[model samples]
Target: MSLRLRLNLLVAALNLGFLGALTWLLIDNHRNSIQEEIEAAHRVTVQMLGSAAQTSPVFGPAPVVMVNFLQSLGRVRANDIRLYTADGVLRYSSPPSAYKAGRTAPDWFGGLMRSTVEATVIGLPGARIEIVPDASRAVLDAWDSMTAIFLLGLGFVAMLHVALLLFLRRLLRPTEADARRLVATTQELAENREVMRLIEAGIEQERKRLARELHDELGQSVTAIRLIATSISRSSEAPGVTQGAGKVNEIAAGLYDSVHRIVRELRPAVLEQPDLAAALADLGREWRIRNPDIDLSMVLEGDLGDLGEELTLAVFRCVQEALTNVLKHAGATRVRLAVAQREDRLEAIIEDDGQGEPNALAGSGHGLVGMRERVATLGGSLETGMRPEGGFRVSIVLPLAGDSQ
Candidate 1:
């Protein structure tokens, strides 16, 4: 249902409940007033009857004057009176009559009034005079007042509802404009996200292409030059020429190694498929060779074959950067590397027993910044701190990817 209709229904329900409560309270007050009036009249009637009997004992002596007097009062107008004999038989009563000049209320109205036998009896030992209170006129007056109040209240609530409903409609008019703007903004954001995805994919493809070209063309050319230099140095024994050719061969070998390293850095081979663990082990082995003094211990866990290329690359880059920092800045002897996967998350920790600054990449080092970004892209977290036990620690946590195999 529409909001407007729902609000209207709620208001209507609340008003109806209020009206019902008010009606009950009014009816209750009227009933209480009737009770008080009847009780008061009963007290007075009892006193009058007692006084009459004290003056002359009509019940005992069968006084003709008192009986005729009571009959005369009954004929004109009397409270609801009934005289019962000692044997439990009705002897006399007030004549049937209307409450007002010519109107008597219906049975429902009578039922709505207070009960009848709530009044008391007043008489001698052999006689019973039941004083049935007659408050029908008062009851009718109360009913009339309640009906007027209800009609007035209902009309007022109707006008109030109409005014408030109109006000709400006017107030909500600007919301439609905001809703349209929100929809447009959401669509723009989605389009931008798709564009970013395409750009990222293109960049990855370009890196792969470049790595292939460097490995195939430049790498092969450098290898041939090194081979020819090696052959010339081995055959020719002229001391000066042999020394020069050896130097040339050594420089060529260095260039080839540099090219190979650059190609691997540009596009990691292990990231093409899953096998992230294998890639990490290879990285550790390389680092061990480079930093022989720094005792490197690797603890790799979990099958990383489920991780996607992007996630694997990101994590691998983080590990690579961390190791570079350790080699460059941290003058430590022992470096520990750990990568583990448990359930839906992958975690890697690298700590070195070196005197490295905790805030090394606070406002410096593009490498560390790039690492942080890479992990963040996959909804992961990175933490760096200096351990109290005398070491610098780098921690990384990443969400594991779905099945990519």
Candidate 2:
């Protein structure tokens, strides 16, 4: 069993044991109390008979008075009673079906009342003595009835506690299952993040290699081709030869332009400057120039100082992804970008007045997923939702400089 189950069982067992002990004690105490009441009743009955025998002699040895006394005692106390005469003969009894007036009392009942035997003795004229008791079989029967009732009550409580334990176990089982699933999910996410970081590092290394080849080997080859074309144009005098030389020159120029575009796309020149805001502004200006139909706005507020390089790169990349998504998906005529300092944190909000699709914003895709991961790396919060007016908004809040530690 699990530790929780073991502990629950241990607690339940302890509770049951305590309750069992308490039930036993209560039953024992109750039985003792009933026995004490029986003893007291027996004493009162004996005293009443003795007093009557001494006071009323007109009803001399009739046995009917003693019978009536025993019957009255039984009626008053809800237990049996009996009386005996001075000649070792039974004189009267109550609960008449089970007791008689002329028979010797049982040995077991005699033993139980041994201490009161002397108290019940009555001396007579013919050297005969009679013995009565403060208790009889009737008292023992009453005790048995009480014990049965006590046991029934204890059994009922035990069964109730058992049902309660089962109900408690069922209630907590689902929460335990959910906790186990959450632990597994967190572990898988951590492993995937490590793998993605390694792949990005490899991609960066390859890009650097291609940039070097384009600047060194490819640029030199293209320059040598241009020099040969120049020589051909200067030496050739025929119109057709000159026209062929010009076509070769135009092809070399086109190749150089293509190579330059490839290098620029592989890596941005502004990433080397180490100023995040400037780099982001330059990107926005370039996008605006490239896409003249869409109007873009930028707003910078508060102190944007004391930022470290790692955080700057992460913020820049997140903004770049957000803008790319906006241009591709948001069919908006206007876009607003805001970067500011709020308390000890930096805040960035990008909003576009486009045909809002909240489902698409939350969907797992390259741009949305990358932006979320980038912001999370800096221990920040990102909120993507639809604005009240009818636009899509991506808002981020990050800890500012000197506060990350």
Candidate 3:
């Protein structure tokens, strides 16, 4: 059930329980009150008749005097009176009450409030007077009063329940404008992520094209220059000519090496072989050679070679960007790069022992932005901050295809 419905049901149940308990209490109190009132009225009537009966013989014939006395008397409240002669004649009886004359409480209600007081009989010389306790009128009054009170209580409870539900709906329900804004923001984010993914794919394709062009064009031209210089140096006899040709060969060789390195950086062998471990190893080896002053440590775990091309490239690029930042800005002497693949995700951390800038990650740097976009496109997350123990840290986590949305 919805929370609102559950709350409404709970409130209704509580209201009903309260009404039930209140009604029960009122019934008990009214029943007891009727019993006490009837009993008291019966007691007074019996005592009055007993005293009058004792004095009846002094005045006249007991039956005749008592009959006259009862005729003068009217119906007593909550009690009935009767006069009977010694020969079993019914001389007089109390008239029905004119107060609320046409009405009586229900039998079940009357039975509930009926008093336990018995009829009292007073004997004279030739007659007897009987007074019986009556509580029907009182019960009827109680029933009417209780019904009014219950109806009032029910109305109040119903109103309170409706008010509470209205309040809850107003408090819990989101505004239409806010809901629309949220939807728009979510769609914008999704569109931006998709665009970033497409752009990254296009950039990689361009890099591959460039790498192939440089390898086939610049690389072959440099090799040809080196081979021609070697042939010229072998064919020349003069020391000066031989030495100049030798210099040309050396320059051509250096140009060839530079072109090959650029091609490799643009499109690594790993892209074709899909071996992340070997790619990282080659990168680390070249970094060590280029920057002998800095110590770089790399740790790989799990089967990184099996990670898909996109994931592998994303991780590699992020690490490369982080290392480049460390080299250019961090002035780091030691860097530790670790990439691990777990059951359903990949985690990479790059930490550098250097003078880390606290605001480095927050800056509008393309490298950091690119890294974040790459990881986000792969259903991953990136974190960058200064380490507590000193230096900067970059952390990345990518969910595997099965683990991703």
- Top candidate on TM-score is 3
lDDT of 1 by residue, 41-132 (tens): 76677677667656556444533334554677663222477777667777777676555656655657657876453656766556666767
Q: How much is 70 displaced in model 3, in angstroms?
A: 12
Clashes of 2: 0
lDDT of each: 0.76, 0.66, 0.89
- TM-score versus the correct structure, for each prediction: 0.61, 0.48, 0.66
lDDT digits (tens) for residues 43-112 of candidate 2: 6755665675554445654355545544565533423444556555665554433443344445653454
Stretches off by above 4 angstroms in model 1 are: 1-28, 47-80, 85-89, 93-128, 132-174, 274-277, 287-303, 306-405
Residues 1-405 of candidate 3: C-alpha lDDT, one tens digit per residue: 999899999999999999999999999999999989998898889888888888889999999988888888888999889888888899999899998988988888888887899988888897788888888889999999998999999999999999999999998898999899999998888888788878999999999999999999989998898888888889989899889999998998889889988998899877888888988999899889999999999999999998988888988888888988989888888999999999989999999989987887678789998898889887899998899999999999999863332
Better of 1 and 3 by lDDT: 3
Ranking by lDDT: 3, 1, 2
Clashes of 3: 0
Query: Which candidate number has the best lDDT?
Result: 3
Judge candidate 1 at residue 87 and give its lDDT: 77
